[model samples]
Each structure stands twice: as C-alpha cells, then as structure tokens.
Target chain A: MALLDYFLRSKEKQVTTASKAKERLQIIVAHERNQRNKQPDYLPQLTEDLLAVLRKYIPVTENSLSVNVDKKDGDLNVLELNIELQEENSGK
Target chain B: MALLDYFLRSKEKQVTTASKAKERLQIIVAHERNQRNKQPDYLPQLTEDLLAVLRKYIPVTENSLSVNVDKKDGDLNVLELNIELQEENSGK
Candidate 1:
C-alpha cells in the first residue's frame, strides 16, 4: 500500500506540473499577441511594461508573438497575433 | 553629391534591415505554430529537431508557441496555434 501511495503521489505531482506549465504558457501567449499588434516604434516600450506586469504575478519563462495580416474588401488589413510561452523543464 | 549619396545609402541599409527582420520573424512564427500542434509527449524531441533545422540556415533569435482549442458544433475541437520570433535589437 505504501509503494502504491508513493507512485500515485508522483503521478499527481507530474499532472500538477504539466497544468501549471500550460497556464504559464497561456499568459505569455497573450502578452506576445499584444506586443505584435503594437506599432513597431512602440513595441520595445510596450514589451517592457508587459514583462513588468507579468513578473508581478507569476514567474514567466519566455514570451513572443507571431502576427498575420488579413486583407479585407478594401485596403484595410486585419492583424492576427499569436502569443507563445516557453516553460522550463523540470524532470523528475 | 557626396551628402546625397550617403543619405541614400543609409536609407537603403535601414530598409534592408527592416525587411530582413520581418522575414526572420515570419519563419519563427511558422515553426512555433507547428510545435504547438504536436503532442505533448513528443514536443521536446520535435523542438530539438526543429532547432537543428533552423540553425543550419540563418541565425534565429527566439521561438515559442501558444495554442488555443476551439469547439465546433458538436465535439470537434479545433486547435489554433501561434508561433513567435524574438529579434535581438541592434540600433544603428
């Protein structure tokens, strides 16, 4: 029973860690999206502010954005931004 | 003539750099999206392989992924992945 309990606990820990990593990735992605939509001249300043806000809550790993522009009927362009998070691997 | 030539060369250099940066960013974003769609268990191995491929060509900055799941009519889940590239700043 003790061995079984130990195995169960380890599995639970792994699950928890994976979920936590996913959550962190979500936040970083959001930040990256915001940065990409920003004007090129303003990106650096905005990125710094975002990093500060994120650091206040949880420790973030890495944040970045990928932006795509979709053209409409006219000359207007719609931007789609993707944000991503990098999680540190902690092997058990 | 000398002053005009110098001005034109500087502007040309700036345009070249901006274009190059944008191209690099696009490649990174594509890679990130690919990674996010991959299964969790295979992510590490996939990431390493991708990095190796990217490194052989031009120098890449930083790459990451963010994934979102959207539910369709019934039980179909569509995954949206965002990939991003981090460019190092070199103010000239």
Candidate 2:
C-alpha cells in the first residue's frame, strides 16, 4: 500500500505470482515445519504421488510443484513443497 | 495470466504482494542455491548484519527481512531470506 513496496518491481505485470508463490511456499513451509522430526527421505516420490492424488480432484500443472529439503537449520530438516493448484473451474 | 491464476485469490487487493513475495523469495532461493556446499549456520546473524549494512543506504523494515534455513533437501542446507527494500523515495 506504499510506494516503497515496489522496490523490487521490474515491470513484469504477473499479478498472481506473489499470491501463488505464497500459497505454494506456505505449503512448503508448513510441511517443513511439521516434518522436522522424521526426516522424510522419499520427498520426490512423495510429491509425485501427492500430485497424482491431487490431480484426481483438481488439475495441476507440471513444474507447479517443488519439493526440497533445506538443511540450514542446525538439527532440523525442513520438508518443503510449493504447489500451484488449478481452479475448480479448470478442473471440470 | 489467465483465470486459473487466481485460484488462491481471496479478494485481497494487495496487487504487489505476490510480486514482492516473489522478489524476496527469489533472493532467498538464489541465496540458498548458492550456499549448498558450505552449509552456513550463521544465516540469521548474516541477514541481520546485511540488513544493518543495507539500512545505511536503503530503508528496510523490521520483519521485512526473514532469514531461515530449510532442511528439506538432504545433505544441502538452504539459506533462505526474504527482504522488502523500501523505495528510494521513501528512504530519502
């Protein structure tokens, strides 16, 4: 809501980038936050399987999901996922 | 770009949220990508120091900068930071 918000603006008018990225990133963040105990190893397979399950109800695009592990934390392993879920209208 | 883009839209008119979030997240992503080998532990301190140094020339808000490590990736510690830089006009 202020002029200073656009310090990173670069003329790209993709309005939904932030919201979508936020949605995806939040999922990843939450997932990472929750799985700090088990240290899930089959993330790639897990994401692929989850994507398949999600596609049954909503259309999802390729590369719209990102799953990774970040070990910057000393003892905690973060399981992160960023997914773009298609609108229900786009589904059926 | 299309109608499906707003699947997560909830009538929040903050058009710059996604753009700004993306900008900040991209910086974090890039930072994490670069430091995969060293497994930096002083990221929060580093980001704080970086913010302090940046404040000399730019106006950055508290909580506008986020520094964290995501351990979702095995063997790679991702250093993540999201910073909102105030516009030059607002800075001066």
Candidate 3:
C-alpha cells in the first residue's frame, strides 16, 4: 500500500510500537518464505543498488534502510531489510 | 560492513532466529533516531524501486523484500523492511 493511504486511513488511529514492529515484520517476512544462498559480495551491492533506485523515489540516505542475510541453520539462510522511512509529512 | 566480513566472522557462530531477528533489527533501528514526517505514497515506491535495483544484483522476485511504515503514540513512526536474501551458495 502507498504511504498516503496509510496516513489517510490511520490518521486518527494510534499504532503501538510492539504492534507496529510485528506487523511490519509480518509484511516483510510473509514474502520471505522462499530461501536461497547468496555470494558474499552480493548483499552489499544489492543494498547499494536498491538505495540508488529508492533515492529516485524517496529520501533514503545511507542509514535509512539495511539489508542482510542470516542463516537459520547450516542450510537455511534469510535475507532481511530493516528500513526507516521519512515521516508522512516530509515524504512529499 | 560487507557480506564477506559477515560470513567470515559469523562462519562459526550459531546465531539463533530470535537473536537473528533482534540483531537485524538493531542494525536497522540503530540509525533511525533522527525523525521526519513523510508523505504516504513514498514507502511503496521506495520498496518497489529498491527491489528493482536489487533484482539487478541478486535473484529477487516478487516475495523477497517487504517494507512498511508504522506508528507509535501517533508521533513516533517507524519505517521497516524485512528482506529475505539468497543463500550464500546460490549467490555465486
């Protein structure tokens, strides 16, 4: 969903931190059930390339978003991104 | 830090999922102390644009990375992305 709809829909509602964290995580993790292994150099490049493109659309500085891969077991690996977005008013 | 460094350093340690989640979050949240208000339409564009660029570097399809913005106490807001990465072996 777009940010404008989010603000317009929830402008009166108060979302809790714990709720926010999990809900956001569910959205991100929901799609990540697929698994793959990556070369060591790829993730950083991915993050950089992603930011370069995201910057064209949003105000993403160096620390605004982070992507990484972590192993679940010896065989299972996860790719995760933690992003900090601009406030709704500033996004314009 | 680069992915190579993460692998070389973490090659031995057994990082748990609970631990993994927090560690990843710490990396994502560590830098978000700065605050800003954003327009609502910015987030989906950011996620989409980021993925478009990331796909150029890695094998990211539709269900790979997820980004969202949530609120706390109405004023404190968060931008979060949960990304699933390729396996290290598959990356090469």
Candidate 4:
C-alpha cells in the first residue's frame, strides 16, 4: 500500500509538470500569433494599414477585403490581398 | 543563348509549380484551422457551444469568452476556455 501511494504521488507530480509546460507553450504561441498579426514589421498588418488608407478614397467597405501573409519557401513569406466589390442594388 | 533561355524557362516553371504547392498547403492549413475551431468532435468547439447555450440564460456578450485548443503531447490535444466579466459602469 505504501509503495502504491508513492507511485500515485509521483504520477500526479508528472501530470502537474506536464500541464504547466503545456500552458507555457500555449502562452508563447499566442504571443507569437499576436506579434505576427499586429507587428508593424509584419507584412499582414502593413498591408491592412495600407488598404485602410486607400479605402478612404476608394469607397470600399472593410469587410470587402481579405489580406493574408503566407510562408512560401522554408524562410520566404508572401502576401496576398484580395478585394471584392459588391454589386449595386437596384431600387425603385 | 538558347541554353540560357531554356534554363530561365525551366526556372520559371519550377517557381510556378512551387507557388501552386504552397497555395495548396495554405488551403489545407486554413481548412484544418477552421475544422479544429468548429468541428463537433473537437473539444474547443464543444465547450464554446456549451458556453453559448449557458450564456443565453446568463448575461454574457459574444466577446466575453475565448476558447482555444493546444496539442498536449505528440498526439494528445487539450482545450482551454476563459471568460472575462466586465464591471458595470457608474452612470451620472
């Protein structure tokens, strides 16, 4: 019974340590995602900002444009910007 | 000159093929992200749906909760859900 109790306690400690490590990793990944999406040097944020400025004169809605940054090669990254214009609604 | 032209054309073709492959990979990754966030079997989506149903009875806004899934080990995945409550404003 004493041996079984020691084994169970060790297992609990291992599980706790694993959970802590996973939480740390999740925080790091979330930070990286935020930085990649919002940093000034990041291509996605730069393209979005540029589009926002251009839209002021172009008469385009914010939801009509979608911009994405994707990895091309192992290290190379590419940006793709797509804009869709809405059809004019006919009214009486 | 012909050999150089052939080499340049082949390089262009290789670049085109690589770009196509990258686009396919991007589509796959995006689909995986959507599936992982929305699929019924996925724990994150299940938890979110549960919370949404619960919030219908309670007072909660759409932006008050954040749910995420993370890989625990080589194969295991874990779900995390966090909810933040806003303080009431003091009106004059």
lDDT of 2 by residue, A1-92 (tens): 12112211211233224332211221222111122234334434544554454454334566566555554333223344444533224356
lDDT string for model 3 (A21-63, tens) is: 2112111211222223233434445445545654564454455
Candidate 4 residues lying further than 4 Å off, grouped into runs, are A1-41, B1-92
Off by over 4 Å in 3: A1-40, A57-92, B1-14, B17-41, B62-69, B73-76, B85-92
After superposition, the stretches of candidate 1 with alpha carbons farther than 4 Å from their true spots are: A1-22, A25-40, A62-92, B1-92
Q: RMSDs, each prediction? A: 20.2, 19.4, 11.5, 25.3
Candidate 4 or 3, higher TM-score: 3
TM-score value, chain A, candidate 1: 0.31
Interface DockQ of each model: 0.02, 0.02, 0.12, 0.02
> Who wins the lDDT comparison?
3
Provide backbone clash counts, one per model: 1, 13, 31, 0
- The B-chain TM-score of model 3 reads 0.38
Instruction: Kindly list the per-residue Cα lDDT of model 4 for residues A1-92, writing each as its tens digit.
Output: 22223323433454445322211101000001211223233434434454554354234456555544544233234444433434344374
Residue-level lDDT of model 1, residues B18-66, one tens digit each, is 4333222111111122223343332334334434443433244434444
Which candidate, 1 or 3, has the higher DockQ?
3
Per-residue accuracy of model 2 over B1-92 as CA lDDT, tens digit each: 12112211211233234332321211232112222233334434544554454454334566566555555333223444445433223356
Over B1-90, each residue of candidate 4 has an lDDT whose tens digit, in order, gives 222233234334544553222111010000012112232334344344445443532334566555555443322343433334333343
